[model samples]
Target chain A: MLERTKKSFLTALWILIITFPLMGLKTVFTGEQAEVGIRADAFYLAGVVFLCGMMWSMKGLIGRGIAFAVPPAKSCTGAIKTSVMKVPVWCWQVGILAMLCAFPFMGSEAELNKYFSFLIETLIYVSLALGLNIMVGMVGLLVLGYAAFFGIGAYTYAILSLNFHVPFWPSLFIGGAIAGVIGILLGIPSIRLRGDYLAIVTLGFGEIVRFVLKNEAAVTGGEQGLPNQHIPGAIAAPSLGFMVLDREIHYYYIAIVIMVLVVFVVHRLNNSRTGRAWIAIREDETAAMSMGINTFRMKILAFAISAFIAGFVGVFYAARMNFVNPEAFRFEYSVLILSMVILGGMGSVPGVILGAVILQVIPWLMRDMMPNLLREYFPSAANVAGTLTDFRLLIFGGIMVIMMIFRPQGIIGNARRKIELGVEEERD
Target chain B: MFQHIVDGTTQGAIYALIALGYTLVYGILGMINFAHGEVYMIGAYIGIISLAVFTATGMTLISLPLCVFVAFLAALFFCAAYGYTIEKTAYRPLRQAHILAPLISAIGMSTFLQNYVMLAHGKDKFDFPGIFRAAFINNTVQISGARVNYLEIFIIAASLVTMLCLHLMIRYTRIGKAMRATAQDKKMAGLVGININRVIPFTFIVGSALAAIAGVMVSMYVGATKFDDGYMAGMKAFTAAVLGGIGNITGTMLGGFILGLAESMGIWLISSDYKDAYSFILLLIVLIVRPRGLLGEQVSDRA
Candidate 1:
């Protein structure tokens, strides 16, 4: 306990020093004259850091997580989770389908549209994260520029549907096709380069794509995004559902259909011959080649399939939003999706979906819903939470770093992937 | 043409300085310091903040060069401190984890630093004060019938001098020799009684100091900077590092010059709006044609 206190104190002090330049120093200007003064938040930040340093998450949770490679995988909530998992798979699926079907009716009529949009957005990310899982988890190739393909998909729909007068249905598949072809083209160049080098290339590619979208003012509509991005006759589609549905409700169901389709396809692909080939390549490229597994083709197939899902989803995203902008597809978005895959349980479908939902819905709740709910009961806590919501990115960054150090296997890591990582547990 | 050359060389010098950080860390750790760009960014913020603080203190009236010198020192100290603290907290723990882990953490670190700066420093771009205006120095110099900014010349000359000092330090100093040994083989270097822990932190400090230098120079050159400015500059510098052979020092400098030249020339030939794409295109061509980079490579291929 004394040691923990000492460490936390030092960490807090160190944070104060590192943050002095930006946090402690404030240049306030009165007309033409300026003064350098210290702000009051330094103490607040120090207190938070000190408190967090001694918290169980810093030791017990992170320590247990790191040591998870050793079986048992015991935690406070682990038993409940295992019990839930023990229930038959089809039973869980039916339960989830019923819940999803009932989701639209769960809220007030006025707020139903907002919930639908939120769930739709979450579903879109679920599809995107699954695609990333194929590359990062299954193939063991980190594509840092996944957002570029997503942008290409969105743009393909916007341009095809808007300028060429293509309808929503063809534009959707064509978007995926174009992105998939480009994914193949991108894969060939970086095929020989492994690990970090591949990451940089993909990162560069993502930026290059974004720059092209921004620079090509005529077609992409530049910084303002594509003009009239709404999918023509999207509301009028599947006429049966359209009759009973509000427009937002229709988009919500469409998003669910896409997500379900993605989950199904990905699940099938996971058990197929090609899936085995990918797992082999990921395990050992040379060994896979020795086994006549054709590592190159399998790797390319992963890229093509991953990009296709992103493109297909991008069309849906554009259709739902009714506007597509270059800003919507940035490197941060790629990283966000990557984090979802990593956080959920990289190679696991249910885990990725759960991860996507947790990351997306929690942030939204923190920002919009929870604070308002808390305002009625604990006003002080609500203020702290509101302030925290403002620093969401900082907390995200901190959690990511802390999580990687403590639990590289993810919260619900795949059994196979855990072996692949084979991280040595650290002792304090 | 002359102007572009001058501009390219000036920008290239800065790239070389930042790329050295990437190359140096990649050399020692075998993982790209994704937050190296964030370090450069923080350096810029610190450099500008220190400049603002110094200007408010009445130090500029006493001796202008001393003011600039003091600002540089402040930036160096804080940047090195940041590099040391970040590595100790974030990267050190993941040394045994998967390769992808460190990269993700770095991305998170990058995001955190950007937002931290945005929150504390405010989102608006800070204008770098005109240092030359205080002194009676001519802001421009005539070179081969072309008027070049004195700041550009200063940036180039300053970086070259710093690089020379770095080369000397690496060749002569005991710690430098240890770093070289560590880079070659960590286990062997450890066996030879070198303190690998000290060497790793030292590498980060030296690299961050170089980035600090570049950050100060670029802020002066650009006249203004924002919280997110480091992302693009960092990417370009990382490309420059890879182009020169990611783990090589001299090659990184050469790569920086070539990349800068490509960007300027590409801008002159194509539209200026697509200048950011030029570095990426150059990277692609290099990766395809000569993956080892222009300098061949120092680190063994991981695969």
Candidate 2:
């Protein structure tokens, strides 16, 4: 009764807030010469608000229902505790709202587009990190060939969409499926290995994939890469009563939506039976196998799922960047992703997100900010200094070392996760 | 094709030297000692610096023994210090922790050492002076329509001498016997009044010096040395060590030659860019098929 009323109230409040922004956007764009579709913004906002409302209501219901069903004294303390919290929900809401609000603040149209493009790129990394976290964090599988899946995804989209003229949406799924299959194939051999051996094998796999991509020039276009990929018609135009897909903000919304979907699915999977199986295998494979769990199957599943996510992101990257090249997928990228997973906290989702954002944005931000900041203060230093990118690899390597020495558990490692990582395990 | 084999053998000899360091440490310590590669890099840089100083004073034609003596001393001291410090600071703490922790630290040390050199010296490839670049003998042995450079002979000879010395040290010396005992069982060695600590450092010093000599030889052959050169060469050498049954000295040497030959043949058959890929692919296949490596004992008792 009270919960129902509260949910209704929240939903109404969300709708009203979204409508207010929609109205503001409509009026602002009315006088502009750009063929901006105010309706699309309204629709997107409504969808976002509705999704938030649903998640909020679901959490409320789950919490109260669990409390009602499981008597406080009788129920296990941990079981009764709510996993869904308001903090992450609010963070997501506030972040998205802030980004959406910035749409109207751009002084010029070009700046607005650039901002949108940046958001799309951020989304790609977010998706990739989430996918990688599945293998490295959740499963405790140290896959050095993570970028191979990304390549698989990219190549799948490139070959299918470019050669077969498949629509972007369908090809995206196909790419993910193809990469997932490849991941499983790789994971099969990986089941027999552990630790360093596993790392070496995956590293080899990554090289093999890269080599094949380079050698199969007839199909992959070799070093030149596939260019001028076509974006799907649905997203290409302002259709389905939505605004045209012209602005960077629209692409940003698309990326955000995809990231949200990936995050939601991964979060759910992390708490599922399959997720528990992965954890069990990671903890002790021999013991896990003794317990009737097929360790090989579970590992393969984790790999496939991770690869699928990478594939999904790859499709978006191809569409967003409108370019695909082997240079973008390199061992360095694999190392970068691995660093993100390590630095952020191996098993923590939020930590992976934090790592991704820092790794992706810091270098670019440093590149832009350092030169001007340094120039204004010390004019002579500017003349002798090279670009920040020049020292980026060195800085990154230094950080990896420092982090390993001081905080191998990563920045936001969970206590239980730390223990499982062998912090508490006694050695002979 | 014959010339390629000769070149491969020459390169393989250098890899064999570096692989000896990896194999020696792994044999004694049961640790990867990832910093071993950086020791090679540092040794090369030190050799170049020492040689440059010597050549500036017109001692370009110094006696071979004197040159080897100075280079060996520098390599021995610097590498020993590096190896000891790495063990004490990075590894000793994590000895009881998860295996991954030390491995990560090793990677960190490798990166730190590489970058330390890069920053100290500008991020550019430094050329080794031409003092040792001259061929000791100018004649080429023609075999099956191919010319084999006589420099190959010197590399093979030098590597053989080093290997023979190492073999003698391990088999005949008291320190060598202590090392073997420690490798077999650290606790037992300690109980038997062997200074395990002393033996470990000695192992490191010997291993690192070998790597250093290999580094100088490689830089000489390649004509230039980059601060980041250790990554590729080190990886290849490490692969050789793994291929040769990790903890076995003779196996490591054999592994180096095999890997070198494979890489050379791969370059001949395909593109040079694919040389690394081929070696790594071979490593992957070998690891999957035989985790124990060639000539390695089946230690199926481990959990």
> What does the lDDT read for residue A381 in candidate 1?
86
lDDT of 2 by residue, B1-303 (tens): 887798889889998999899888778766677777888887777666555544444454656436645755665566666667666667666655544556656766777678666754567786765545654435578778887666677788889899999999999999999998988887889999999778987888788888888887777777778888887788788888887778888888988888888889889988786867877877877877887667666775243
Top model by DockQ, which number?
Answer: 1
- Estimate the lDDT of model 1: 0.82
TM-score of each: 0.92, 0.77
Error (Å) of candidate 2 at residue A306 is: 1.9
Over all chains combined, what TM-score does candidate 2 have?
A: 0.77
lDDT of 2 by residue, A160-272 (tens): 76667676677778889998999888888766776556776787788788888887788887877775343444222222344445456666777777888888888889888
Candidate 2, residue A234: Cα displacement in angstroms equals: 18
- Which residue runs does candidate 2 get wrong by more than 4 Å? A1-123, A228-251, A361-365, A376-390, A418-423, B23-36, B61-80, B85-89, B142-146, B167-204, B269-273
Question: Evaluated with TM-score, which candidate comes out highest?
Answer: 1
Residue B88, candidate 2: how far off, in angstroms?
Answer: 4.6
For model 1, the superposed segments whose C-alpha errors exceed 4 Å read A1-7, A29-33, A53-81, A228-246, A376-386, A417-428, B131-138, B298-303
Weakest ten-residue segment in model 2 chain B by summed lDDT: B51-60
Model 1 TM-score (2 dp)? 0.92
Candidate 1 residue-wise lDDT, A1-428, digit = tens: 78888988988998888788788888754433457987867767888899988894367766776677665656636988878889998898789978997888888757787577778888899999999999998888978899899889888887776667676777789989999999999998897777767877898899999998998889888998877344455322323433633388888888888988999999899889988788888777878899998788889999999999999998777766767889999988998999888877778888888878877876787676776778877887876777767877777777778777887656677766557658533311
